[model samples]
Target chain A: MATARAYTNIALIKYWGKQDPQQMLPYNSSLSLTLDQFYTETKVEFLPKQTNQTADSFVFAGVAQPVSPKITRMLNLIRQAAGWSNFARVETENHVPTSAGLASSASAFAALAAAGAQAAGLQLSPRELSIFARHGSGSACRSIFGGFVVWHAGHDDQSSYAEPLLATVDFPIVVIAVLVDQRPKKVLSSAGMQQSVATSPFYPAWVQTAESGIATMSQAIAAHDIARIGQLAEANAMQMHATTLSAVPPFTYFAPMTLKIWQLVQEFRTKGLSCYITLDAGPNPKLLCAKQDAAAVVKKLQAALPQLQCTICQPGPGVAYRD
Target chain B: MATARAYTNIALIKYWGKQDPQQMLPYNSSLSLTLDQFYTETKVEFLPKQTNQTADSFVFAGVAQPVSPKITRMLNLIRQAAGWSNFARVETENHVPTSAGLASSASAFAALAAAGAQAAGLQLSPRELSIFARHGSGSACRSIFGGFVVWHAGHDDQSSYAEPLLATVDFPIVVIAVLVDQRPKKVLSSAGMQQSVATSPFYPAWVQTAESGIATMSQAIAAHDIARIGQLAEANAMQMHATTLSAVPPFTYFAPMTLKIWQLVQEFRTKGLSCYITLDAGPNPKLLCAKQDAAAVVKKLQAALPQLQCTICQPGPGVAYRD
Candidate 1:
């Protein structure tokens, strides 16, 4: 048995559309920061043929679940890669909230990739593991690395992988994720992205912009320019949402309170406190600011929007295996 | 005294950012549909020197208001254009709701341009009137002509003017303006545009996309393709709003109900009933559909959102003189 854990990652530059949907390949490169506060742990045990297990069994959060098509497919990919014909039993525990714009899939798939490969007696590098993990979820590749990580949008399966930056950002950066809604969104990211790529007139430009943003963001991270990095992240997320709005029969992830929180961030800037806001395909707003100011900022935000719950996080470690 | 009435025009391809702020010249050309439901009537009377009036006096909605800087500036621009130095008394009545996402400024300034020029004893052609009107508000140029009007974004103030499309679309298209809120928006269009132009990283691409959209929309108009025209209009408005979201300290005009109306339009399409949704810088949604379906669409929308008030409108005439 091999158990592994992977932390969730919040994208600084967003990944919206897929160049290859079947393979889960992204149209543009993206950067993300792995969070210390939340993660997923998975244990995988390969069952011998003598056990007469016809299919893999899955358990989530201590509850036995019927093997979903997605989980079955992910397990099959691992079996093929490791040359293991035996079936497996997998158990996963989620430390982060699932399906709430928290990128739970990132940690879930990363941990699965790591533990499943190890349990199958395969020794693979992080890059190889990332390629395997990406088959589960496009963003899972980034969860293989800690600190600032960039997912290169390569043309083929082998070339597309994530690698950690040479320069670890020295400044204390705080990411305050304001949980506005915990319910699964009506429009799934996969469905929403497919619609955007097919219909949005502005989509082609978005790909080009995100590609260039990767290079700019790399330099900002290297230089430890928190303000520049935060600004780039904020703009990138907004542009991503823009494509959604521009899609034929447009849609938006924004609720009324989403805009209200954005307004609060702007108000903070006006008072000489510089912070940036980014949101995924959900109503929650994540504020990036100096680590020292996290408490004060959260205080102000809670006072203004009393119902909001903020989770403070910093850079976390990459995927690790346990004996 | 000379009075002119001009109906409001909603841009199918929006004009957002300006190349020249003082001249009110848009970065890209735009097309608009003049609506018959709402209008503004303005009477301009030049006060003689014997009357001892040093400044222009303004009245709106039967209430006398101090000459605001915006009004003063608009009057000054007209004075420079007509070569008239006399102060004027401007009485304006808004048949449309003011500053509520209903292009009230478009009709107001278009009326002022026509009546103000006439009261100064200046005879200007429609093309010349469009040029004068653009100085007051960028979108006002399109309101000079009825039906389908295209405002050519020219390099100089004299070159930019609106011209009626040669192809008069005889299709029975109905525009239903959904009034979600009657109260004035907190962010005025003028200030919002300035901020977006100054800060949004996506503004340059927006200019490029909007420029091409104008040509594509013109062809759709020429072909009398209702579906194509409505699709182009919907995408254009959303792209314009996207720029606002990417603006530094980002803002959105959308309320929660605004998105609800948009979803309803998409639902209409899925049901084999085609309808398109567009919005300006406010929460109100404008639905474009076949005239035969207007009553049914409104009925369904009111059923879904009881608080919504839908105003039905059709193609209106150009700026007209009133004795």
Candidate 2:
């Protein structure tokens, strides 16, 4: 048996739509940072098959759950790659809330891919593991590496994978995630992206901006220009949400509190503190700032919104295996 | 003394950013329908000057108010064009609330332009009147014409003017204005436009889309396809909001109730009603539908949002002298 752990990542630059729906090819490249606070651990064991027995079983949160089609498909890929015919039993533990604004799938799938491959007697490089994890969830590909990571929109499945943008190093970065709502959105990211790609006239512009923005983002990261990176990241997220609003039968991930937080970030900047905000396909708002200002920023935010719950996070390590 | 009345208009294709700040030339052509419910009546008189007296006095809502800078600038333009040195006394009555998500400027400025020109003994055509109004506010140019109107984005001030797309006649359309809030936004339209034009990466795409959409919108209006027109208008307004969100230090006019109404409109459609929504730079939402279904739509909307104050409006006449 092999067990592995992976941390969730927040995409500074967003991936809004897919270029190829079936293969999950993204419309553009994206950059992200894996958070230290949230993660998932998974253990996979190959069991000898009995006559007329279930081929695979997935146990989640200590409850035996039926294998979803997506999970089944991902397991089939691993089985085919490892050249193993034995049935497998998978047990997963999620440290973060599922289907909330948090990126639970990114950590869950990355851990599963790592644990499953090793348990099947297969040794794969991180890049190969990333490709496998992507077969489960697109953003999961980025969870293979920690620190600053970039997922390239390679033309085909063979070429598409994520790698660290820079060596694992401590940067003066901090993210305070403000959880406004933990409920699952009525429109999932998968359905939202499909609708945007099919209907929004400005969707093409978003793809172009996101694809081209990666180079500038990398430069900003290398120079450690926090302001430039934050601005670009904020704009990238806004562009993604823009596609949703412009889509036919428009929708927005913003709960009213989202705008209130957005305005407060600007107010914070006017007070001479450097801070910016980024949102994903959910109503929660995340503030990106320097580590030195994290405490003060959190205090100010708490004073302004007394009921809000915020988590302070920094960079974490890549997916790793345990004994 | 001369008095003129002009109704306010709601842009189906929004005019957010400006191309020429001084001349108020828009970045994109826009289309709008003048509403019958809300308007402004202004009377201008070139009074004889008294020693040591102020050059101009403005009376608004039956109260004597100091002449604002914008009002001063507009009066200067009228004086320069008509070659009058006498001081002017202006009295204005607004049927609609000012700076409260209603296009009060559109009617106020258009009526001022007409009455100002005639009071100064200047005989200008409707096109010239639109050009004069453009100096006051960009959208004001469109209010000089009735029914379906298009504000062409010409290369220069003289060429840029609004004209009736078709002769004044009733169309099968009704606008239900839902007033969610009457409070002024923290960010004014002018500052929002400037910030968006300078910072938003998606602003260029908005300009391109708005320019291209006018042709399709005109075609739909010609065919009297209420559904098509409503869809295009709704998309246009959403695109404008997208630019604001993508701007550096992003901002939004949406209150929580604004989104609630937006979702309710889609719910209305799922029930086999042909209704769409358009929003300006405020928290209010306007629903576009056929007049025949107006009563049923209002009933449903009131049921969902009991506190909402809705006004049913249809097309009205263009700016003209009041007896």
Candidate 3:
């Protein structure tokens, strides 16, 4: 029987706003790239016989600790339906630095999903697997696939799901990770989505316009059109951040030096290098350019914005079994 | 004598952030269309003997009252440097209802710019007029022309000013205002922008990507392509509000009904008719479409969404002399 499985990191080109907080239905359609190289090695065991009043634990990178209160509550809710209340231990090991905030939740949840199913010995489809991972972090929905992926915004519990593009990427795809900081400088917690949903007036617009962007983006990705993908990702990412900006009381997660690096990255594009940038709640500016220009773009961006250390990586495999 | 003069209403296609809040020199490039129907009537007569000590009154419609204390300070700031302490009794009326919350200030100051030039006996070029008007509102800079306009992001006092479109709009345009509500909303009033400037981690990304959107939208508008124009405006507006959502407090101006009308409007386009919606501040949804289909679109929209009352109008005349 197909049970638990580990997924990889997914980046949404069309994302912003969350609808049902518990279920994590996004307000817009989002495109993502599930990568290899980095992942969360996780195992989850759900005990139908454990005691009801105990707490859950998350041991990340050999450090044993109590899980986040919110996560504990979510786990409890899921288990409540099964009439099992004993504690579950979640173990996650990162291929990358745990403190760097390299979107570890995407992988962490993917692993938990795979391991939880293995422990429970319950079979699940890709859609069920995607929905289960969504309980962990919304972006995890895309981690179920490798290569290019798109998350469709369906209305109900059975409606929303993610699908992968079978088309090959002929163009060179590269991500130059400019390391501006070694530690995640505290972004809006995932709970911010729920808060934003309740407060933001711009959230509906974000939801209403998701389909067209997602549809166009998937086409651009499938065609291996670097420019279109970059353009769509940049706009979609910006839209994601913009929805947060329009949220009631308003919030932002930016580093002062982030702007300086962004300028340097775009200056290269404006100089006609065919490069574009995407960011996710961090000061580091990721440079997306052709495989031919990848090294040059990294070197040039490093020279221009020396504050951010650069690391070049290509698209790799999705979540899979380890030898 | 200070007499009535005409000015256009400009809707910017690409506007991201403000470099100087006091002067409203936006950080991004923006394009606009000068409408024919919407205009602000203003009369400016310089009282050479009036001193700065007395309060200058700003009367809306037929009511006469002293300017608000906040505006008094801004006006004083403008007057202190120019040595134009003379009070001008500027009376203004607008086609867009005062409470509708469209950027009516753009028209108010654009007309004031025309009347101010006439009253002050200064034959300023469009750039000079823009500089004077920008002191009032950033959107006012593009309201100087009859067709299309662009505000080139110039740095500092010397280079910054808005200019009319080098290329005019090729298609006849009409705007249908579906009145959702006339009451002013409780949005952050850009307290978020100032806060995000200080707090947002993505502000740099916001600035870096703005130019491309602006440049692309400019070309789209210059070509008079409705689909491109509509796409860019919707995207650009959403981008602006996104930053607001990410502010530390997180907020948005959207309501449930706003999305319903938006869906209906976009549904029209999907049905082979041309109609696109853009919204600001209030819950109202404004449709931009061709003149030939505008009336039918408005009627259809009204019938479709009775919760929203629709009014039809066209691209207004340029700033002109009135009896």
Candidate 4:
């Protein structure tokens, strides 16, 4: 039995499309920053084969639930690598706020991969763990390391993995997660990515730009230039969303409130505030700024939008074994 | 003195980037529908050579104003074509509603081209007039014809001009112009197009897709397929805006109110309303639907957003002499 915890990450240079969907190989390199506020903890216990229990059992938030296909596929890979066929009982606890519109898959899969591998009696390094976690979710590999991490878009499964650009952030950077809508996403990220790759005329440009974006972002992080980092991340996020808007049967993750917040961020910048916004595959806008400006940014946001729920997060540690 | 009036147009297949800025040659062909609701009338009189009146004089909306560079550049082209050096006095009347976000350039420049040429004693064909109008504004060439017009993206000055696709509409189609914001644009359309051409990585794809889009739109218009037309127009408009969002120093015309109206339009469609939306380089959105559904779409839009200003327009005639 083993339990592991991992923090969630938000990509600076996004990973939108995949070159190989089955193998989970991305079309371009991506950079991300792990956040301290939200995370997941998963415990895995391998059970010996028995007559009655022939499948994996899963419990989420203290409620027994049927094993999802994603979990099953992830476990199959683990079993194949570890040379074991034993079924497992998995329990997960998520710390992400309910209805926040933020994705928890990164941390959840990272924790699951670590705990599941350990429970299966497999010894692996951090890089190996990141590669294994990617089988469950592409961004999961980034969560395997804290601070700034880059997931290299390698040609094949053996070469693709994430490495820390700055393992311990020496600068004072902060993120304010602004929750806009609670409704589920109309288009899932994986499905949206596939559609973009197949239909969006701008897909090729996104891949080309993202490669250069990763290199520039690495320099920004190394120099501890918060403004440059924020600008690059904001541009990359907008470019990723642009690809989706041009996809066939066009779609956008921007809700009305999301646009409102985006405009407000621009207005804030015009007023000499140093903050920039980034979004994932959802309507919520996350503002990245320096730690010194966070309080002012949050106060101004609340004053302008009294009903908003804002959470501040800082750089966090990578995945660690709980037991 | 010669006076001419030309109706405004809305592009179903947009004209964005330019392949040649000096001659105003476009990157791809575009199609537009001339509308009866808005128009411009201009009178040009070539003044005899005098020491005191050395340059052109201009009056707009009953007030004398300094001649704009666009007007001067357009007049120069007319003078060169007519083999005359006499300065001109131009008067213009715009019927476009004050603060409405719709552009009047297509009609305004088309009328100027016709009136200026006639006043300079140049007898030119409609195609020749369109070629001259391309000097003032790119889309102005499309205003030379009625109903559905195609501005062919020819390689050089002699070949690029507008021609009537379906000079008379045999089917019922309506456009509902939803005025979302009254603020002036932050980036001018001409500058925005130039920026996109220079910076956007997706521009190559845009040019390629637009050629195919023009061909498909021609087929749809011939079949009188309102749904297909709306779908194509909406996708094309979104793709055009997507390019702007991916440009260096990315910008978007989507104001908060614009996004709200966009969501409302999508919701109306989900509830069985047959309408699609397109936006230009500004925040206002134009919803296209069958004539039978215009009233219902307007009612639903008003009920959802009581403050919205909606204008219903149909296909209109081409440019004609007022006197």
**Among all candidates shown, the one with the greatest TM-score:** 4
Best by the DockQ measure: 4
Give the least accurate 10-residue stretch of model 1 chain A, judged by summed lDDT: A96-105
- Candidate 4 residue runs with Cα over 4 Å from true position: A50-52, A98-100, B50-52, B97-100
| Alpha-carbon runs more than 4 Å astray in model 1 | A62-81, A97-101, A166-171, A215-228, A268-275, A296-309, B47-51, B61-84, B97-101, B166-171, B180-187, B198-201, B215-228, B268-274, B295-310
Candidate 4 lDDT by residue in tens digits, A66-127: 99988998888889989989898999999986634568999999999999999998888889
Cα lDDT, all candidates: 0.85, 0.86, 0.63, 0.89
lDDT of 1: 0.85
**Can you give the TM-score per candidate against the true fold?**
0.87, 0.92, 0.53, 0.97
Among all windows of ten consecutive residues in candidate 2 chain A, which has the lowest summed lDDT? A95-104
The per-prediction i-RMS, to one decimal, reads: 2.6, 1.9, 14.3, 1.1
lDDT of 3 at B64: 82
lDDT of residue A268 for candidate 3: 84
> Considering summed lDDT, which 10 consecutive residues are worst modelled in model 4 chain A?
A95-104
- DockQ, candidate 2, vs. native dimer: 0.56
Per-residue lDDT over A72-174 for candidate 3, one digit per residue giving the tens place of the 0 to 100 score: 7546544654455656777668786332335667777766665655454445677776677677777877777777777776777567777776423233787
* Per-prediction TM-score, chain B alone: 0.95, 0.97, 0.86, 0.97
Candidate 1 docking class: acceptable
Model 2 lDDT tens row, B196-216: 899877788889989998999
